[model samples]
Target: MGSNFFHHPNGWVGTTPWWKDAVFYQVYPASFKDSNGDGWGDIPGLISKIDYLHQLGVDVVWLSPMFESPQKDMGYDISDYQAVYARYGTLEDVDQLIEACHSRGMKLILDLVVNHTSDEHPWFKESRSSKTNPKRDWYIWKPPRYDSDGNRMPPTNWRGYFAGSTWTWDEQTQEYYLNLYGPFQPDLNWENAECRAAIYEVAMRFWLDRGIDGFRIDTVNKYSKRTDFPDAPVTCPGVPDQPAPEMWCNGPRIHEFIHEMQAQVLAPYKAVSVGELSNTPLPKQVLPYVSAAARELDMVFEFSMIRLGTGNLFHGKYMYTPFPLSVLKRHVATWQTFIEGTDGWHTVFCENHDNGRAVSRFGDDSTPELWEASAKTIALWQATLTGTLFLYQGQEIGMRNMPASWGVEEYKDVESLGFYNEAVESGDEKRVQAILHGLRILARDHSRVPFQWDDSPNAGFTGEGVTPWMRVHDQYRELNAANQLGDPESVLGFYRKALGLRKEHRDIFVHGAFKLLAPQDESLFMYVKESGEQVGLGADGNRKKALVVMNFTSRVQRCPAISGALGCRKGDERLLVSTLRSGLARGRVEELRPWEGRVYLNFQP
Candidate 1:
């Protein structure tokens, strides 16, 4: 089916393909594993884990940047567009990993980062050399302006996504360069047709030739910027846009770029594409990108829930407001309702390498029992929803947040460093402490901490005397995989059970309609998915239907009784799986143990 057809949710109306329900697992390469003991994870390391992913029961594997990079921004700072990083082994290693995933009946989704390029990249090198160079127009450049006092002024007021000014003055070219990220990462000028075409070509041929199932485009909507580069009105006190970022983010030409990408590249292969839409409001501008015309993406990841910890001052000053569950449920419910009747698809995620653990954010991770239950409940809630569920590494094992004691030296994320420097440089010790503490709760390193495969040193990710790039969590001794695989109540086991239900009841869970019930309850997060007589892809034609009730609050609570279509007396229902007990009597209105949840299979009214 064509890209345009993806917008209609009516199960591929008029030859459009349907992707309403799928599961994607995000893999961060460097922290994933180390095959050659270099202290960094590689592709061969990934090839060894294909079976593990298959066992986890995910349909897609979304690998983080493996493209050549300077490691300045981890792998997000790309130096080469086409070549695989040598530290990750040869291109053949990637080929082998792709084949392994496909052989197990799973698809691979490459992380496509097109927003900016590393300063070390050859294209940037040539473009920044001289004003008259043929590649000069490839990046956003501007002539410096002199202030009334003769001091040079930036062309615009835009600040970097990290921190600092977005413009860098280069005496050599006598021009200022535009960068929404770090100085080393230069934003490409999408207005330049040559540059745009080059990016599209690179995105196309790689997946087309290599047989990748799709792509998860990172910072995708930022590809287009405002034309005039008008100065943004002040929103925050310190963070001002030089001609504002609003002028640049989601520019007028964005749809054109998406349409071109779809027409020239994505459409021909019938490949799936999802944009990582940052700072963009949902059910409005973001939704159109994934609209029925298929002009751009298969789905877009809206970050409202991810930004919960930020409060009102999200990116500016800091606060310790533990994200409220009410706020989380509201945003999720609104988004789900907005796309409930659309052909456009939604990409669901609770954790990613760039964020902290969901187990820590949503549940009590300090204790083993609560940790296991919370992790299981989160997995089921996301998986059973009506979109592509994205699971981050270490999530299956219910990884916790970074240790509060991990000081500056132990951190590797740029966001952490930027906040640390800003806090100290500005002499706000109290604010610094708060930001650092928040980092412990929200930074990507918490998720990137070494995968606890076993109780071995370095959490089985590296050997002794080999320093890891980041500190591994200290709980590896007790929380490692070797122990969890034996315990059915472990977080890993609960994940298996959750994924198993998703796979086993594909028609009801994967492609079924999501009916969110009891939205306002603070203690109970309840919902039901009705297959309504649709048959799964490979089943014996038996209809599948289920009622999934999750108790989000960490206390015993009574879920709202189900009537109408779902037949249940008072509350007598067989417990399919529970963190505390085995059998549940019908119409009993049983108590839900703290952080506990249950699902009933073939439940009838």
Candidate 2:
């Protein structure tokens, strides 16, 4: 595998990087743990959990934003890039946490949010103070345009990501400022050289100087924008302005700015960066950012898989229909095959701070019996894939979406609240109900609930008398981590076993050739991994193959024979791992139980 190289378009050859073999775990600091009983998780609380992460076989820890802010967008709007929020800990606490992770053979990366800043940030405040202020060019500002009737209008017909017009009028300056997200979070002007340098100093250099590993850059592809700011074409009816992702996402100067960042800080520290490419999913557009020859980013988180069953316009991610399993298989196959032996890399994940739980969205979670089996099957499926695997905090314990009985007030996410309020103000009762139902299943708040550690009050996230920042899941009493620590068949236990198997057979699982079997089968997801012919493993004089079969349905399904495909006798196959505790055949699996998965090692041909 070491001799294999991917040729680039510029006539360069590249080898694998360190991040390809690592497993990343994302920690949303505000909901992870609370050390002072303040109803919020802190850096000190995270420091106490390093041993838990190390035992789970995690190689890198990706922490969400904990920077100083007003909590409007839950730390995404940064007021001070260098200072940590008081509710979370101090800069000194972050230093201690970094040391703790390194002492245990782990690396830590921070969330870099440079696309925008809090309206209260000193830079933005000065920029908004007056048109002639020295920092006025730090943010995007435009003169107000008027109609023939003398009514004031925004510069362009573009909608904010949350809601309403993208350009907000500032009373003090008498000019409008661009805010792609909520009004409180103003977008920065990357076209200005001084603004770009200042952002690099605080957002990247300051953190790397503290001995951190790298960054999970938020909206990395949104750094540049079309200078003209043309009006977006109308897409949704009854809405004056429409979403213009094409105008700003992957703009003309995006690659130039990213390459500058790579040369300035990331390369010097030998850091690893996984960027969030908003609204860019095509392999042609995504390869330039992650290809080794580009020297831009190590990998990127694509949204094609997560946007499977989501809604658009008025619905806003609230789904009314079930996501088809056959469509998901095709999406997975497209990405896996496109970058099989290329210079580009991929990120494999099912849940994150922005999406619903994995088991509830992709697998069966209606019953306790099926929930455990389905969660284990999902774990096995992720482990056998060829990329960097990222597991959200509560995903290992089989967490599900919030209950539908809860009121809309229980959700604290800005996006969810905006969608609900807009539907209510329209005087549409049926639309309001449908939006509420969608929020229950697809809201970001479901992943932001406090982590369930034990059966105690507040799910062991806070003191018995203190109320949590968000409501704990109603099933914490039965699905807490303490009960699963001792049960070998628990979802958390199964995740550990599956990850261990990947590490043990890195040659076959990480560097092997991938082939999808039964592409049209909706109930079964079967694939093969071979190490010798494709990845230059034959030089070692040992060739190996692994067969992975998963049942993605609630009902029993027939399993296909694998002896011919693997070039091995029927009795020579060895079962490496199985999600079922019993009733699994030894050599050839004739049938698979509901939500079952199995991995077999076939003897060399």
Candidate models: Cα lDDT each: 0.75, 0.86
**Candidate 2 accuracy as lDDT:** 0.86
Candidate 1 residue-wise lDDT, 72-134, digit = tens: 898788998788888887778878888888888787878888888898888888999998888
Candidate 2, run of 10 with poorest lDDT: 1-10
- Which candidate's TM-score is highest? 2
Tell me each candidate's TM-score.
0.91, 0.94
Off by over 4 Å in 1: 2-20, 238-245, 312-318, 532-545, 562-575, 581-589, 601-605
lDDT of 2 by residue, 290-332 (tens): 9889999988998888766678733365644566788888878
* Global fold similarity of model 1 (TM-score): 0.91
- In candidate 1, position 474 carries an lDDT of 82
User: Number of the top candidate by lDDT?
Assistant: 2
Residue 140's lDDT within candidate 1 is: 88
